[model samples]
Structures are given as structure tokens and as C-alpha cells.
Target: MFQSILSNLAIILLGHLLMSTLITYRERFSKHLLYIYTVVLFSTVSITMLYLPISFGDYRLDLSLIPLIFLALFRGWKITVPVLFIVSAWHFFMGSDETLSSIVFVLILPTIFTLLLYERKIPTNINLKILFIITACWIISDLPIILFIPNGMEIFKNTFLLRYISFLSVASIYCAFILIGYKNDRLKQRLEFLASHDPLTNLLNRNKFIEIVEVKMKESDTNHYIALLDIDHFKQLNDTHGHLTGDSVLKEISSIFNKYESDNLKVARYGGEEFIIYLKTVYDKQAVRTLEHIQNEIRTTPFHSNNGGSLHVTVSIGLAKFESGSRLYDVIHQADNHLYSAKNENRDQLVVSFD
Candidate 1:
């Protein structure tokens, strides 16, 4: 009995590990592919549990409800139904005369009851919720034995009744704790990402950009440049068109800059109607060519308005080189000075030098 308990635990822990790993790296998969992998995983775990039931006098108790409750709670009907079908079909193949009824009591009914708990249809404390669901599923699990086996009631009352709860309750609570840990871990990752990224453009925010620049300044062996850009007559354009159109213009402009992003180049929406581009290069000429491409692309690409008409816009750019050992803000200040010059003198110009 101890060995059987150990074997069941090993299987359950392995299944949890696979699920946690998938959730951690879920972004690497397409949504459909992730769904397929999840179905296969839970179905495999449930089927494996059926084959490893811990034996009593006349009945074997498999930890089927653990996986069923988890799948129904987390995944919903779409995923649970398919998993149930697969598990039931495999149970039928195991050649029980009571297979059809076992499906009703063991897997399906418990899953539905657990899912109702998931929906929070009734208000209950968390402990009570867990207790109620586990107790109900436990009762359902005993139904097949009581109905189909001879002297089953005496066997169940004497051997299986008390021991089953201790195992299932401990295992269920342990699994719940693991899932709660996974949820918190994923939440922390999401918060970190949201902190570093701009909600509007999904680009690196100003502070994150600054952090990266500081790291790059310390490590970069080649020359570095900052290209500060502002949309020409942006306020007037916003006043002429609506804010929605203005938002569209900003989104389109951000999309244009996103195309030029690479290992050596990064871009950020610095503030309203302004952007910053950071570049690392061996040659000053290479830096200027990249800036020119970006400027020309923004100038020529037609932006869309809410009224379905197209609008043309241009960016005034100020390029400044980062001299070794100079403060980052000092370089940014020079770029701003040049930007002021570009804005004053012309609507669309790339100012690349002190001259």
C-alpha cells in the first residue's frame, strides 16, 4: 500500500511539473498548438492514473478526480470534454463490465461539480469549497464499488472509506498549493514585463531604455549615436483631425520605426509626439544612413485618419554622437539643442553636425 501510494504520487508530481513548465513558456507556442499540447498532457495523466489504482479488499482507488478537478477548473468545458472522452475511451478498452457507469460516476459527474465550484455559483469559504468538492467526488468514486462488487459495502466501510480521504485530501491540497505558486509566478512575470514596456506602442519605456543605454555604454566597443525626433506640426494636425486619428498616426509611426529595430538599434516613444532612436556603429556614415532611412520612411508613408482620408507627416531629427566617458544626459542635451534648431529652421530636416 505504501509503495502504491508512492507510485501514484510520483505520477501526479510529474504531471504537475510538465504543466508548470508549459505555462512558464506558453508564449513560445501558438494558441492552437498550446491547446493541443495541454489536451494531450492532461489526457495522458488521467489515463495513466487509471492503470495505477491502489488496491483495497475488492476495489482499486485511482486518483482520477485530482486531474479531472484541475482540468475542469482551469481549462473549462472545451478542453475538459475532450480529455474526458479520451480517458473514458481508454477506460472502456481496459475491459470493465461497469465501464459505462464508471465514466458517469468517476469522471464526468465529479468534473461538472468541480466546474460549478470554479464558477463560484455559491458563496463558500475556500476550505469548505475544497472540502465539499473533494468529499462529493470521493462519494461518487465509491458508487461503482458499492453497486458492482459483492460485499462491497462491508469492504468499503472496513478498508477503503477512511484511508481514501487522507490520501486524496492531502494530495488535492498539495496540488492546489502547486497551482497557486504557478499562478503567482506568472503574475510576477507579467508585472515585470508591464513595468518595462509602454502600454501604447509596446516599445521599451523611457526608464527601461535608459537602463539598457547605461549597460550598452559600459560594454559597447564601437561609436554610439542618439537620434531624437519630433513629428512636425503634430499639435496642429491633432487639432485639425480628431484624437483617434492622432492615435492612429502615432501607431503607424511606431510601426514604421519598429521595422528598423535590430541588435545594434533600438527605438522608444520618449513622450508625446517625440521618439528616441539609439544606434551602435563602427562608422559615422553608417549611423547617418540608418537615420536617413528612418526619416525618409516616415516622411513618405501616408498616415490614416478616422475620416478615411490619408495624411502626410514628417519628423525633424537631431543626431548626436556619444563621446567616451561623457554623461548620457549630456549627449541627450546636445541632441535636444540640435532638435530645437531643426524645429525652428525647417519642418523636415536631419541635423547631423554642429554646423
Candidate 2:
């Protein structure tokens, strides 16, 4: 009995490890690839249960249902549906007389309930709620073994209690470990986001934007255009309306910048009231058109002030083109020069230069 318990514990540990591995690779996998991994995981757990189950008088217990239940709760139908097919096929091939019954009572019913429960908006304490639901479903699934199988009541009274205890013990420990892992993963992602993004505007910060621009310049064989944009008379606006208004205006501008962001276009907050844009393409005309669009949008939009008034502002833009082998500093310097020219010549329009 002790050896049986240890083996089952080992299986649970192995399942947990496999789940952790899958979580790490999830970002790299598409929906189909993730489904394939889920199928493999389900197959392994099923095989482990069939070959090395804890024996009772007329029933066997294994942690095979652990992965199935957890994945169904956490991953939704995209993963759970495939796993259900694989496990059902395996059970059918095993030739157990109870195969049909198990499919309905054991797997199908619980999965249906789990899916239904998962769609509801969980208000709070989500992890605790899920754990409770899983435990309830697990105990509910074990009812047939306790009531219907020959001498099941006697067997459960004598031994299945121990099996239940073992199962819950392993589950509690493993779920706690996974909870910690979830917390760590969330924290890591939060830190990465904070590092690259402005907290106020949620736009790319200067350092990360420059880093990306440098890499793109080095790798792309085509021409790239860098534009420097400055909000005209920003300090005067801030002085007139206060810094709160200044912040609101900046956020509004950032939203407009973000609206145009795409694979070939990147926008970032260069500094206070200033932004930098990187546009990648072979045609300078396309880049100029995009710049014109951005300028027109900003020029027409009136920033709403906190004191119930519309404040109109305009921006000066300087555009410069760079190709492979051009220095990043030189490109930016030229753009800055053009931006200064725009500000000096006229406050509301763009200045573009190629050669």
C-alpha cells in the first residue's frame, strides 16, 4: 500500500512537471500546436493510469483524471476537447466492460459541467473557486466506484477512503505549486511590461524604441524613415493650463500615435511633449503619406481640457530617410535638424528631406 501511494505520488509529480513545461512553451505554440501538446499529455497520463493503477477489490484508482480536470478548467475546450477524444479512444481500446459507463459518468459529464462553470464570470478568489470545483467533481466522479461496482461499498469502506485521502493530498500539494508558478509568471510579465512601456501613456519608452530601431536598421535591407515630432509651444500650454492638462494632452497624443502603430511603423515617447517614429519601407513616398496622415489627425483634433474647454494644439515634424549602413545617430540628428527647421519656420506643419 505504501509503495502504491509512492508510485501514485510520483505520477502526480511527473504530471505537474509536464504541465509546467507546457506552460513555458505556450507562447511559442499556436492553437493547433497547443492542442497537439495537450493530446500528448493526456495520452501519457492515461497510459500511466492503465499500467500502474492502485488496486482495490473491483476498482482501480489513478491520477489520470487530474490532468484532464485541471486542463479542462484552465485551458478551456480548445485543449480539453482533443484530450477527451484521445482518452476516450484509449479507454475503448482497453476493452473494459465499464468503458461506455466511464466515458459518460466519469469523463463526459464532468467535462460538460466544467465547461459550463468556466464560462461564468468568476467574481473573486478564482483559484480557490476552481480548486473547490475540481475537488467536488473528483469526489462526484468516484461515486460509481463506491456505489455500483460489486462490493464497492465494502471495498470503499475498507480501502477506497485511503485512496481518496492519497489523491487529495497529492492534488493539494501540486495545485499549490502551480499557484506559485502562476504568480511568478504574472510578476515576470508585469516587470517586462513596465520596463518597455510608459506607465502613463502605455506607449513604448525611449530606450526600448531606440533598441528596436537599431536592430531593424541593422537587419532590414530596405530604406527606413525616422521622424522626430514635437508638440509646438508645449511649455506655454502647460504654463497656461497646468501640468495636469499637459498630461492629458500627452495621453491624447499618444493614443493617436498608437492608432497608427503596425508591423512597419513604431511610435514611442522620446521625452516630454516629444515623440519618435520609425517607418520601414522601400518607398519614401509611402512614409511621407503616413507622416502627413499623422500630422493632419493631430492638427484637427482638439484636446479636451479639465476645465470644460477645447484646447487646440499642433505639432512640428521632421522626417529623414536612412538606409543600410547609415549611422543611427546621423539619421536622428538630421531629423532633429528638420524638426527645428519646422518649428523655426512654421509651428503647425511638417518638414521632410531625403538627400
Candidate 3:
């Protein structure tokens, strides 16, 4: 029994390490961690079958409850039911007699019921109701063995009691681990998002925009167009109102851009009141038309202030198509120059040039 336990523990550790590595490779940590735990639990069951003694008179403890709890915590009831069924099959195949097999099946039924009560969210507390139901199921699943044993009541009093305690201890530990992992995963995601996005407008920041633009430019055909847009008299707006009002206006304009922009158009908050849009197309006229439409939309929409007042804002845009032998920076500078010219000439117009 001691050797069997050690071997199972070793298997669990090895499986955990392997699955953790696989999880690290995934983009999302929450799903990865759940999958890792499931793999480890299944590996533990397989290892136990190899090393553990299963005889007619011997009462073998089932470790399948761990996976059910994990499934419930991570994937909810839908996954737990199927996992329970698999565990039951594994138990029957590992030399468990018909009586023990029936008992295992019976015990798994309550787990199904317990799982049904699980919401997709991990419970803040270990659910006492579910725990009690699980205990009851385990007892019921062992009923056949309990009934047919030579000293049936004595076997239930000693063996089943110990098994129940062990199961609960393991489950509690698993739940704690899962919760910690969940919190850590959420924190990491939040940090990553903040690093990539502007806090005020919730749009991609200049740094992230440069990274994306570089990649796109390297892979892009020569026909793409790059546009720079500047909010006309943005500093004046801040001077007239407060910085807070200016921020609100920026946010409002960002929302409009997000709503109207297509997947092929990459928009970013490129420092202060300046924004950049990269349109992946050969048609310079289409890109100019798109910017004109955005300018028109902004002009028509009245930005309401907290003081029950309203203001109209306009944007000056300059666009240039990508040249075959030119650098990305060169394209951006050309667009910025044109934007400066637009601001000097017509504050709310778009100027498009391929040359």
C-alpha cells in the first residue's frame, strides 16, 4: 500500500509538471491551468491502477473524486458528468469486482447531482452542500461492497470512514490551488492589457501601434495606405474647458473610430490628440473616403459635457499610399506633413496623395 501510494504520488507530480509546461505555451492561462489539473488527475488514476492491489476481499479506495471536483471548479457540471463516467469505467477495469463496480457507479451519481449545482464560476467557499452530497454518493457507491463483506458494518466503520476523510482533504487542497491560479491569471491579463492600451481612451497606445504597424508593413503589399489624423485645436479645447473635458472628448472620438473602423483598418491613439489609421488596401481613394466619412460622423455628432453644455469637434486628416522602396517611417512622416497642411488649409478635411 505504501509503495502504491508513493508511485501514484510520483505519477501525479510528473503529470502536473508536463501539463504545466503545456499550459505555459497557451495564450490564456485559465483554460490552460484547468486542462493541466485534469491531465494530472487522470494520470494519477492510471498510475494507481498499475501499482495498487485490487483483490476480492480488499477494499480499494477510488481517487476519481479529485478530477470530478476539479472539473466542477473549472468547467462546471457538463464536464464533471463525463469525467465521472470515465472514472467509473477505469475503476471497473482495474480488477474491482461487480459489487465494487456497482458501488462506484452508485457513488458517481451523487457527484453528478452535486456537479449540477455548480455554476461556471468557482465558488468563493467550499460548498458544504455539494460536499455532503459527494460523501453520500461515495457511501452509496460502496454499498454493494459494504453489504457483501464478511464483517460488513465493521468494514464500513473503518475503511469507508478513512476513505471519506482522505477524499475531502484532497478536494479542499485542489480547490484552494485552483482559486489561487485563477486570481493570478486574472492579474496577469489585466497587466498585459494595460501595457498595450491607453487608459483614457482604451485604444491601442503608440508603442503597441508601432509594433503592429512594423509587422503589418513587413508583410503588406505595396498598395496599402497610411493616414494620420489630428483633432483640430485640441489644446484650445483643453484651454477653453478643463483637461477633464478634453479627455472626455478624446474618449468619445475613440468610440466613434472603434464603431466605424473595419478589421483591415488598424487605429491607434498615437500620442496626445493625434491618432493614426492604417488601411490595408491599394485604393488611395477608398482610404480617403473612409477618413472623410469618419470626419463627417464626428462633425454631425455633438459632444455633450457634464455641465449640460455641448461642443462640436473636427479632425484634419492626411493620407499617403505605401511606396515600394520607402520606409514605414517615411510614409508616416509624409502623412503627418499632409495632416499639418490640412490643419493650415481646411481644419476638417482629408488630403490624400500617392506621391
Candidate 4:
């Protein structure tokens, strides 16, 4: 019994290691990973069925609990139920009538219950509910064998109770590891996002924006436009109202920028009251039209503050097209110069320094 338990545990650990490695590799080769996992799991189930068998008195046990539990937790019920049925049918064909009947009851009923639990989306803390249901099924399935044993109560105490306790402990530990891994992955993703994004407007921050622009500049043809836009008299707005109102104005304008974004364009919050738009397309006229539309949108939209007051805001936009083999900073400097010119000249219009 101890050897059987150890063998089952070793098989489970080996399968887990293989699955973890495959899942890690799948992150790099996302297209074929699911196919690989399906094949591996199916093969594992087949091989395990051929090798392991449990014994109690004159009754034999189908040592399929590990695979059934794995399928229940990972693949859920849809695939598990069919797999359980197939394995039970195979056991029946192998001429273990008593074991086959017990296996059928154990595998099929627990799987159905598992499916219902999953459908209900029960809390993860309800492992005891799962344990109770599985224990109930196992007890009912093993009752005939228990009654036939020489010392039935002693056999139940030594075998079924001990095995069930061990299974419960191991299963709970397995679930804990899975939950921890998921939480760790989530934390890593959030940290990566926070590193590359601005907290204020939830836009790409200045540093990431520059890195993206540099990469794009290397691949850019001679016609892509880079525009720098600044909110006019933004400091005065913050001074007149509060910083809270200024934040509302920034968020309002950020929403306007989001509306104008497209696959060919990238938008970033360059700094306080300043934003950048990188347009990849060669149409300078369309770029001008788009910027004009954004300016018009901001001009017409009355930004409401938390204090039940509304304020109007305008932006000065400067557009410069990248010439072939031009430095990115030089193009940005020219755009900035044009933006200052717009602030000096029209305060609410776009100035183009198309090359």
C-alpha cells in the first residue's frame, strides 16, 4: 500500500513537471502548446491505465484516481467525463468485472459532481465540499469490498481512510501551488504595465514613447508625421482653478486623444500638459486634417470639473514629417519649435513644418 501510494505520487509529480515545462514553452510557441498538452495528457492516461492496479481482499481497484483528479482540476469536466468513460470501458474489457463496476461508479459520478461544482463557479475554499463528495462516492463504491474483507472495519481503517486523507492533503497542496502561480503571474504583468505606462492618464509614459518612436524612426519611410501638442495656458488654468480641475482637463483631453487614435498612430502623455502623436501613414494632408479635428473637438467640448463648473481648453499642435535618414531628435525638435510657434501665433490651431 505504501509502495502504491509512492508510485502514484511519483507519477503525479512527473506529470506536473512535464506539464509545467510545456506550459512555460507554450508561452513562446503559443499556437501549438494546447495540442502538445492534449497529446501528453492523453498518453499519460493510457499508460497509467495499462500499468497500475490496486488490490483489496478479492476486489481489485482501478488506479485511475490521479488522472481523474488532474482532469477534474485542469481540463474541467467536458473532456474528463469522456476520458473517464473510455478508461472504465477499457477496464471492463480487461475482465475485472468487480473493479470495473466500482471504477465506473467512482469515475462517472465524481466527474458529474465535479462538473456541477465547476458550473456553479464555487469558491476555491470549498475543497472540503469536493473532498466530501469524492469520499462519499469512494465509500459507496468500496462498501461491498469492505463487507467481504476478513476484518472489514480494520481494512477500511488501514486502507480507504488513510488513502483518502493522503489524497485530500496532496490535492489541497496542488491547488495552493496553482493559485500562487496564477497570482505571481498577475503581479508580474501588472508591474510590467505600470513600468511602461503613465499613472495619470493611463497613457504610455514619456520614456516608453521615446523608445517606441526611435524604433519606428528606424523603420520609417520619408513621409511619417510626428506631432507634439501642448495645452495652451495650462499653468494658468491650474492656478485659477485647483490642481484637481487641471487634472480633469487633462483627462478630458486625453479622452479626445484616445478617440483619434488608430492602428497607424501612437499616442503618449509626453509630460504635464503635453502629449505626442506618431502617425505612420504618408498622408500629411490627412495628418493635418486629423489634428485639426482633434483641436476642434477640444475647443467645442466643455470640460466639467468636480466643483460643478465647466471650463474650455485649447491645444497648440505642431506637425513635422520625417525626411529619409533624418535623426528622430532633430525631427522632434523641429516639431516642438513649430508647436511654440503655434502657441505664439494662433494658440488654438495646428502649425505644420512638413519636410
Candidate 5:
């Protein structure tokens, strides 16, 4: 009998599409752009729903609560607060006699429900949990309308069941929409990370390292130093142990590099058993001390094989400070020369360029 909510139902569907698209594609958009987009998004949908409300036999109601609740649960306050504020201000300013009731039911009640549930542990699956809260919100908001307003019981009898069913479906569909979009975004981020990082050590891969180094070198006037380190007798150690053990040793060395890494320094896996470090330092001595510290840490740290066997390990380091007018490869070649010199003389030593 009450097919009048068709427009509101359609509005809810549009809201679903709008919100889902934003959630899925937000990584592509800048932070400020997305911020404006969300505020406009929720405010527009909410205000439109409120203006074109459904006729509940005699009372008028809008399906704005679902989006408000969704925003609260997922987007948190940054997006939710401004959207809530914009919608609330519009309703309070442009509304009629039932404006107070509209604020309470359409805006405040659902938001409070979401706030109480935020980050608190609940025992049920997400869909059911959301359903329960939606139902509670609907019931609470309708009761005052059902009791205080005229013919409240008669309106409840005529339209409550159908309206409830429609809105409950909208809330569940909105939940699914958000979940699928969120999963897609996360998967995209993971794939991007894997593409640019070495899975074994989770360090920057060779190509990514070169990309960053080129940019950093061109942009800054700071003194830059490069150090190339290679494991001493890595092949022999792998032959004595196993490939798994070799992998463990590599990861352990990566962890030590990570410990010393800072904003001024970057580290990457150049190739097998070889790591490159780049840093900005005012004094050549600082570069020497840093490389020496890394060299010492490697010597002292225990290396383990796959079968839990303890093994000895050491690295030879070649350090060179970048000259302003020269190319990146020139410095790398110089570092390589020093590295071979260290290996030829003795293993487990640090060699600095005379230049």
C-alpha cells in the first residue's frame, strides 16, 4: 500500500554507490581532495534524503541514519564529524515543526549508537552486529514518534513493518558495499608494496632504490655518501649450510641495517649477499663511523641456519663520499674498487676511498 518510499529507496541505492566508489578509489585521490569529497558526499546525500522524506502513513521519515552510522563505523571522526555537522546544520535551519524530532531521530540517535560501539569488541559477525544496532536505533527513534505524535500507533500498524524491512536491507547492503571496497583497496596497496620491495628481506629492490637515489641526489645539496657491503665467503657459507640458512643470514643483516636507518640514510639490497647504503652527512668521519658501526654490528651479531645451527658471518664494506660534479655510477665504481681492495687484503674489514 505504501510504495511512496520508492524515491527514498532509490536515494539509498545512490548513496551506496557514491560511498562505495569513494572508499575503493580513495588511494588514488589526494588526502585533501578526498576530505572535501567525503564531506560533500555525505552532506549532499543526507540533506537530499531529509528533504524528500517518505510518508509514514501520517508522519514523515527519511533514511538518513544508515549512512550516518556507516560513516561513523568506518570513516571515523575526520570524515564523520564534518558530514554530521553539515547535515545537522542544514536540517536545523531548513526544517519545519518536527525539526527537533528530525535532529534526534535522523541525526543524533544513530550517531550515538555508532559512537558507543566504536572500537568496542562485540561477539557476533559484522553484518549481524550492524543489523542489531540498526534495529535498535529504528525502534528507539520510532517509539517517541509512535507515542507522542498523533495517530502514532495507527501509523506504526500501517507502515512500520514494510519500512523497517526496506531500511534494514539498505543497511545490510551498505555494509557489504563498504566491506568489499575496503578489501579491494587493501589488496591494491599490498600488490604495490610487493612490486617495489624484495620479499626475502622486505628491503627496497634494486630498481626502486635507483629511482629514489636519482631523485634525492638531484634535489638536495647535502653531502651524500655511498657504502657497498658484501658478505665474506657467502658462497662457501651457503655450500656448508643450505639455501634456507643463507636466506636467514640475509634477513638478519637486513634487520641490523634497519636498526641504523634514519631519514638521512637509505638502505637497499643491490643483489645477492650485497647491500648498498646511502646517507647525507656533513663530515666524512661521520660516514666512516656509521659504516664502521654497521660493520662491527654484523661481526658481533649471531647468524642462524634454517635448522637452528649457529654460524659465523662477516662483511667487507667499501665507502665513498659523493663528489658534487660526478655521476652516481662513478661513486659506485669507486666504492667497488675499495670493496675489492678490502677483500684482496683480508676479509671482514672496512675500506675508505682516498679521494
Candidate 6:
């Protein structure tokens, strides 16, 4: 019996590891692919539990509810509902009528009930809640057994200690996996944040900005335009006021850009003193008007310096509207050329080309 428990535990731990890995990369796959993988995983764990049981007289106990509960708690009803049907149906079809009915009812019915508990209140004190729910579900599942089996109450009273131990063992494994899944989620979030945002300004960095724009260009049905804006005399500002002031100016401009940003517009810090914006505007007049608004906003805003002084700045914008079959680099180059035209013509002007 001890060896059988150990073997079952080993299988459950392996399943948990796979599940943790999948949770880490859950956003990487399509919903349909993830659904298939989750169903397959739960089915394997269920079959292993069904086949391998700790036997006492005519009764066989398997720790199958552990993973089933985990499925509902973490993956939710979208995946868990289908998994419940598959695992329960498989057990009901394959084993002896008495054994399978007992297993299926005990495993499936109580797990669904526990899912209701979880859905209503996702407690902050999760570990204690897990133990409580699993124990409660186990006892609740056995109510039918107590009523139906011959001398059922007496049998339950005798085997209460064994049942507690089995449930505790499974609950411990579930707790471990839950912790691992949360840790992986936190780590993935941190990684994604660092990958997509600029450390200095908290704006989308150049690479991520370009990647998003290219994706939008591919997916968009409407016309989009890319505009590059450069701060006038930024190097001179850094030389005169120091890099600290330059950093402050960048942060100030990023805040303004973010304030004016909308669903149809994206603002990114392209590089030093250069910002990139993408607008989902089909008409040249709309794009020009939006750029003009931003240009005026920056021109009028004052940047406060550390030495109780105020600095005024102007920006030069170069805009290029995307054409059919035009690549991102090509559009950007056109914008860059127009930017130089604005800089050459005057430091505080806008140069745009719809052609």
C-alpha cells in the first residue's frame, strides 16, 4: 500500500511539473491549442489515478481529486468542465460498475461542488483554503458511500484515519504546485515588462514599438501613418544643463505624450531625443491635425530645472503616410527624410508627405 501511494505520488508530481511549465507559457499558444494540451494532461493524470489505488478490503482509494480540483481552481471552468466530463466518462466506461461508479461520483461530483466554493470567493489565505476544500470535498463525496455500502457508517468510522492521511498527501502535492504556478506567473510578468518597456521613461522601447507597429500594419484594414519627432537643440540642452535635466525633459515629454494618447494613437521613445508615434488615421488632414496638436502642446509646456529655473523647448516632426506594399523600414526612412527637411527648414516646424 505504501509503495502504491509512493508510485501514485511520483506520477502526480510529474503531472504538476508539466502543468507549471504550461502555465508559464500559457499566453504564447492559441486558446484552442492550450485547451487541447490541458485536456490531455488531466486525462493522463486521471487514468493513472484510476489504475493505481491503495486497497483496503474491497475498497480502493486513489488521489485523483487533487489534480481535478487544481484544474478548476487554476484553469477555471472553460478547461475544467470538459476535463471533468472526459475523466469521469473514461472512468465510468472502463472499470467495474461498482468500483467505477464509486470513483466517478466521489471524484467528479465533489470537485464540481468545490469549484463553486472557489468561484464565489478566491480567498487570500489560499493554502488553508485548499486543505479545507479538499478535506470537505473528500468527506462530502463519501456521504453516498456511507449511506449505500453495507454497515457503511461502521466502515467509514474505521477507515477515517486512512482517508485523512490520503487526502493530506494529495493536498500537500496540490499546495506545492499552486505555489510553483504563482511564482512562474510573477517571473513571466517581470520578464515581459522588461522586454517591452523603456527603463528610463516607462514608454514602449524602440524595438517593441517597431514590432507592434509592424503587427498593426499587417492586421490593419485602415491606413496608418508613422511620425518621428526630435527635440530641437537637445544636445545643446544636455551640454548646457547636464544629463540630469535632459532625463527630466524626456520624462516630461513622455508624460505629455501618454496624456494625449488614445486608442488610435501610440507613442514610443524611439531613441535619444527622438520619439515615434503611429496613428490609425486614413485621412491626411486628421493625421496633420493630431501632429499639430502634439507639437503645440510641447511648445507651450515649460520644463522645470533643478536650480529653480524653467526651460522652454520646441520639437520638429516629420510624418509619412503608409502606402500599399510599403515596408516598415521604408516608411520610417521616408519619415526620417521628412524629419531632416523640418530640421533643415526650421527647428520648430512640421514636414509631412502623403505621397
Best by TM-score: 5
For model 2, name the residue pairs that clash. Answer: none
Global lDDT of each candidate = 0.81, 0.79, 0.69, 0.71, 0.80, 0.83
When summed lDDT is taken over every stretch of 10 residues in candidate 4, the lowest stretch is 54-63
> Tens digit of lDDT per residue, candidate 4, span 13-89?
56666666665556676656566565557546544744654455554454455456546655676667667666666
Candidate 2: lDDT of 266? 97
Q: Which numbered prediction scores highest in lDDT against the true structure?
A: 6
Ranking by lDDT: 6, 1, 5, 2, 4, 3
Q: How many clashes does each candidate structure show, in the order listed?
A: 0, 0, 1, 0, 0, 0
The regions of model 2 sitting more than 4 angstroms off are 1-6, 21-38, 50-58, 119-123, 146-169, 218-222
lDDT of 2 by residue, 178-294 (tens): 677777877888999999988888889989998998888875667798999999999999899988999999999999988899978999888888899999987888898999899
**lDDT (10s digit) by residue, model 6, range 230-255:** 99999999998989999999999999
Per-residue lDDT tens digits for candidate 3, residues 10-65, read 44445445544555566555775665566545645543543443222366654445
What are the runs in model 1 whose C-alpha is more than 4 Å off?
Answer: 1-53, 56-185
lDDT for 39 in candidate 4 is: 51
Error of 4 at 292 (Å): 3.4
Best to worst by TM-score, what's the order?
Answer: 5, 2, 3, 6, 4, 1
Clashing pairs in 3: 103-141
Per-model TM-score versus the true fold: 0.57, 0.84, 0.75, 0.71, 0.86, 0.75
Summarize candidate 1's per-residue lDDT along 136-166 as a digit string, tens digits: 7878877877787788787777876555764
Model 4 earns a TM-score of 0.71
lDDT of 5 at 178: 71
